[model samples]
Target: MPTALSSTDEPTPYAAPGRVAAARRAVGDVAILFQFRRHAVRRRHLARVLSLVFCAITLGAAAVPALCPGAGESVGTHAFDIRLLLPSAWAGILVLNMASAIASGGGRELISREEAAPYPVSPTTDHLGALVLAPLNIAWMVQAWILLGSVSYSMPGNRVVGSEILTLLWLVFSTSAAQVVAWAVEAVRRGAHGIAITRTLLVCLGAGAGAIQVSGNATHLLDQVPTRWFIVGAIDGWTWRWAASVAVLAVATVVAVALGAVPTHLAARRLPRDEARMETDQHAPRPMPRSVLGILIRTDRASVWRSVPMRRGVLVLAVGPGLVALAGDLKWSQMTILPGLVASGGALLFGVNAWCLDGRGALWRENLPAPATALFDARMLVLGEFLAVASLITVVVGGLRAGLPTSYQLAALLCTILVVTVQVVGGALRWSLAHPYPVNLRSARATPAPPAAMVGYSARLATSTTFTSLLFSGCAHVPDWRLPVIVALPCLLWSGLRLAGTRQRWQDPVTRARVVATVAA
Candidate 1:
């Protein structure tokens, strides 16, 4: 029997009110997500964690004197040791990085990207609705306040705490200044060159500080240098050294900001679609050159050299070693490991972002004429270049002054270095591939990548550290062998991030309450 007009066959139960409500809910959900991010990025819990961390450090520092502080009056009084040798080596490495950047015309020159004429689009008018207007600004202010609070916590007359705060201030200048320079350079000069200029300037600042000591010593203007492989040595706090150093940094910051703000031809002629939003225009690297390596891989190396993200990634890993090594005073041998560590660390970090950076294009490549191996090889080559530069500057100069260990010892050390680095890179790659990081930035400063990215990186790092520690138990040469427990530890960090991101990508929208914008007027 024919049923009376079925509701399914006729118009379904749809209403305008429900549709409108759904739309509102979608927008609300987005707003809620943004609020959560604001809190996460601000690291509401970070202050507490940092307070505890610093307290532990301070207590340990205080105990040194009461417990078993070195009786030596000054670093110079001590014979050549790791402390003295490490910094000297780091200084050398920095000088080399600066020289390479300057000579290459910047990191851009080292790694090239396509360029084109700029569209007549104005950034100010393009974004009509909600956007991240001042992420960097918010972050910067939070960091400033954090620094102020941390320094305030140290006991009165604690020169170490004061010096630490000042160094952090310099970093603030560096990041801010870089933003200004990059903006101005892109505005006026345009093209990849503008980016290169900023990279070179930063590299110079980092390298120059270390090179100064070497130069002074070479010229006999200074009798000795300061170094400790992994720590910043005690500053004189007694006189104008801190003020002078601060003044120099301040001047540099001012100059960079002034130069950066001025508009340039570059602003009018940035790389066409390539420099625009990357997600909008993804392209395959041009054909491979028919050369020695190219003959084997059937690809052009230069075309695949993506320096910006990868190089910057490398720099992130390098930063820890770079800062730690930038100490004063040292012996002959301690410097060697620092450079190796820097180079390998950077490469591993880059690997995490590699597959993701490849995107669909990379996947296609993996499926086609070039395999993942090819891409990996080319990327590794790039890593090698960075390592050579880092290690050459770090190891050679530092090693020479710090003194090299016996050949076998050096080999073991080098092996350890490579292994650690590989472990780090592998872990980062696994993390990045499983999860991902936020690439879009309103400012030039490479703020913390997505929290997921960091979490992944940390997980991998921990795993890697443990594995390498255990595998090379004898080579690690640390005081204790128990540190390797991290290697075999089971974890689902990358899985968690991937799951969260996927859920966020697919979840239904919701309506939410609003909050006031928290940024400077």
Candidate 2:
């Protein structure tokens, strides 16, 4: 070039008329925009909505104390445990470090633009950019923390703060599972069992350690203060508790870091390309079913059974929430949590699948011939099966452990009513939130859920109102179980109506679509 083009230089009008060049540029821009739109829809938009939700919940729940915390003096509690503070700070530091590492490794790109020209590309630069982005992610996390922190403070701050170590441990384990799964998949795909073996051994060691810890806990060695020990830490309570916690955390961290390495590598290798393969490859299952509910159930099953990674995820999700309830019952001797917490959590854990999963591929299959009733029926049946089994277990355990017969009777009726209502409404909402485009067979996520937000909101509102009405209308202060008729009536009526609604609505495409979009959203 006799005269190199500069930023100030405007290109001459196309004398040769390069149509292909113009077309290429236009196409590229469109592709980029589409990717950006999807990313924005999933990341920025979703994050904002979730953050807002958390803030609202926190504020609303906080105000509830002023409204009511029920009879009996509410004893506000707190403890200054320096030992805990140190570990908590350390855990936070670890979180920041992990966040930075992920950011540098291109996880941030999941929600950002590609690098422009003039930026030097190197390992150091990649890490630097990630670290820079870390602050943004940390900010979001801090907002989230504030939201949850408020809830914990209002409900159980000490427990929540102490539980940070546990939460972090679980998060680490989750990271490990995700990574272990990815590497296992990739390893299988690439015919490399070596990585798989390494992963398996690490997992086994972690499991073995867990068994030992559990045994120790059972024997009271894990929760008791160690005698004949020189204690230098800033806390009193129990050296045993701290020792067990630290050991558990250390094990979890090791496992998490070991597993996190794979996903990081995948991101570095290029996530966009890999993600496409994940979403649209022939290697995955062929299209499952067309109906929203059918799709959701199938997807849920697939997540648990199809891939080794998702299977692990399902186990954790299905089991993890109940862990605290179990510990509480064991310690408190008040099976208040048995049916109330475990049953509901397990059912909801399985039930929420209907909202997002059921709505998958709704657009493409809307015209496809599929039985609406069967779709809804099958999904509810499976979910109900799980709930029924858990509920039975909870009821039996709760009945035995409850100190008062009246409490047991009351709890049983309350639980029965709640489970029945949940079965039907949960089914309907799950089936209704189906989005058409970018039909995710997995259906656990919504890139662009169909627009039934209003209906879904109404469903939740109605459910809430019914619950409040049942409780407020002389039910809340019922110290003894007298009106079994009242409890049974509401429970039975709600359950019947819900089931009827699901049966009736499934056949109506418009109704189903509206519900799917709203519920899924």
Judged by lDDT, which candidate is best? 2
lDDT of 1 by residue, 252-343 (tens): 75565334323322343455222344335466777656644454343322322333443444444455344545444443234434543454
lDDT of each: 0.40, 0.41
Q: What value of lDDT does candidate 1 attain over all alpha carbons? A: 0.40
TM per candidate comes to: 0.45, 0.46
Off by over 4 Å in 2: 1-263, 266-310, 328-371, 386-489, 512-521
Misplaced by over 4 Å in model 1 are 1-332, 343-345, 366-393, 400-405, 436-452, 455-521
Q: Compared with the true structure, what per-residue lDDT tens digits does model 2 show for residues 46-152?
A: 54575476457545543433233421123433322322233333333444343323222232221123322343232222322232223233233443354334323
The number of the candidate with the highest TM-score is 2
Error of 1 at 158 (Å): 8.4
Sequence-dependent TM-score of model 2: 0.46
